[model samples]
Target: MTIPKDKMLEMLHFLMLSRRFEEALTDLCRIEGKIPGMMILCTGQEAVGVGMVAALRPEDVIITNHRSHAHLLTKGADPKVLMAEIYGKRTGCNKGKSGTLHLALPEIGAPCTSTVVGAGPPIAVGRAFAQQYRNEPGITVCFVGDGATGEGSFHEALNLASLWRLPVIFVCENNRYAGAQRQEEHTRIENIADRAAGYRMPGVVVDGNDAMSVYTTALDARARAAAGEGPTLIECKTYRWRGHGESDPQLYQPKEEIAAWRALCPVARMRDAVRARGLISAEDLKAMEARVETLVQEAIRFAEESPYPEPHEALEDVYA
Candidate 1:
């Protein structure tokens, strides 16, 4: 499963972009107070989003959890529009109606995002069922946190997806924490993927920090689903470098653990791997970083310059 150098570079670029974008949002919230809503930064888990989404076609749909900035960016959603949405601007992807946690970009195949725990899997199952009924070849991807495994909806959705042989990939971004509680304290199972056996589907755990590893695993899962072999549960063992959200005190996570995971920074790891392979030069890496910085600045500017939605327009999109 040797990924091409060009594709690896692209992954690296997206990883950097996601990280920088989150950082920009954090700065806005903490320093400028420009962003109006809560944010969950995927600082360390960029690899999982970049790797998995890169393997999918443009038509493939992705359903995401609350921590969705990485997923949306990887799915080709406009960063400026996302930033505007965070700022509650009218030019946002959802017309500034839904903020960070409830982004909806249908044009890019990321129809909607949910802030509720474990709610995305069932929705993903419904989307996959519709595709199956319509004889559509597109697949659905449901991104869930490790904590989602404990939810009844998660198990029920898996059961139904397996029963119908739905073309949905259940991706558990196991960051080892469900909100403030650690995984060991909440769940009896060692690996979340182990539960896949109960549903009669293939389950595999991959190094979520390694982008290429996740990419290859996603390729195999996509192949299996395309062949009607049923849904696959992929548990990506990764960690979040930031708190659960912007305002969380993060009292539960130890400083040592945070430092250790920071040492395993996925962006730096990919950059080193690419440079060591001579696929990209030091100059190339620097240039890429410069470009990402410029892009992040542009997104910030776009969000700031964008106008807020008119008060009268809120009633226009409402169905009730």
Candidate 2:
């Protein structure tokens, strides 16, 4: 499916915004020492986030793993709220309690997120079940890392989703590495989507770095789900630009491989593509960057002024 020029430009703009936000976060972590370290960035995976969000309605649900800033931004989340959350301010989306792992904005269908690997799939299945039972038209799109597929919950969620034909789209960001381990050291399957056959559903593999490809595949999967078709396993061939998470001394991979992945940076490619297509002028990109910078600055101010959680409130949310 060819996206209109305007929509493509919009996605490109959003992708650039997300990249700038991540960069700001990294700078904050390094310069201000606000966060302990840099986040595992989705630098080469912007297309997946952009494309998938394009296929979704405002009311449609989305759940994802720890690497989900792009998802939040694409869903129209305020940059100020996100930075506030990362800063652990009471005015954040989750009252500054969720941090990087658990951010949610129910109004925009971002219910919550999980830092624990593979937890999103089951939750997505549960959300799908609820929507289906309520006769709602919304579908759930879940993002998982390649490492997540090794978890038992991944299989369990897929099985249950297939059994009930839940409106859940399982998007696997197979960056070929899980934390410090390479995919070669993990499962033996040549393709993660191949496993979907066991559930009797469609298995799709797409270039995750290509925004149009991701959007098209996600649109197809979502259409199938809405039509009562079974779940789909979409393995996105992408790469990570940073270490797994903050404080990861990445020794498991080689510098050459990292450099190689850098060549396929999603945001950079999209910007070039849009320019080549004459969809956006360079000045337009500059204007968008200025807008994103303003929002980021406002976010920092908001986080600084916002209150922190009280001493006793932490225990209140904890279940025994």
Candidate 3:
């Protein structure tokens, strides 16, 4: 499907934004020793996040996995505050309580970020049920990695969601590996989307590296859910350039394979499409890049300058 020129440009803008955001965050963790914890960067998965969120309404609920810093940006998270949150500053979205892996922009309808292996689908279905029961307006989007489907909870969640015909969308970022374990080793199925047949839902496999392709596929899924046709499982076949997390050396993954995926880089693909279409001038693209760089630098500066939460406020937002 051909997206409007304006929307295409917008998608390109966000792809750039997400890429720069993660690249900057990586620098903070690696070169600067600023962020603590196992920070996972979705360096090559930018298209999936941007495309999914582009198809979704702002009111739509988003549940994501650990590789979520860039996903948060697609939902309109303020880069400055998000950077501050990663820094565990007082001005964070969660007020320095939930760091990199568990940031939530509830007001933007992205309520939770789950790092557990297969925990997101259940919550997504629950949120979908709540919206349906309340006659609410939006759908729930459950974002999971390819490894998540190996868990029993993932299957159970899909079964229940299909049975109830809940308005939920299950997006699997099948990045060829489940945390360094190649797809060939664990799951025998050729395509993860084929598994949806067992759950009695429509499963789709899309080019995760193609921003427009993903946007169109997710757009169709969004329409189906809105029509009360039950959940749709979308498997995004992409690859991550980095290891599963910061600490992993990723020796299991073949360097040649990583290089191949990098050549098909989603960010570069989107930029090239923009240039080919002449939607934006070459100078415009450069200016956009400069703007994104400035935005990320400002975010880092803001986070560095902000103070951490006071010692007494540890339990401020905690239920326990």
Which candidate, 1 or 2, would have the higher TM-score against the true structure? Answer: 1
Report lDDT (Cα) of residue 276, candidate 2.
89
Tens-place lDDT digits, model 1, residues 1-320: 67898889989999999999988877789966577868788889999999999899887899998889888898998889998998999999998899898999989999969878999999999999988888888899999999889999999999999999999999999998999989998898889999999999999999999898999999999988877777999999999888999799899999999999989898888888898889988898999999989988998899999999999988877777
Per-candidate TM-score against the hidden true structure: 0.98, 0.94, 0.97
Weakest ten-residue segment in model 3 by summed lDDT? 24-33
What number of clashing residue pairs does each candidate have, in the order they appear? Answer: 0, 0, 0
Question: Each model's C-alpha lDDT?
Answer: 0.91, 0.84, 0.90
Clash pairs, candidate 3, are none
Error of 2 at 88 (Å): 0.7
Q: Which stretches of candidate 1 lie above 4 Å from their native place?
A: none
Give, for candidate 2, the lowest lDDT window spanning 10 residues. 31-40
Arranged by TM-score with the best first, the candidates are 1, 3, 2
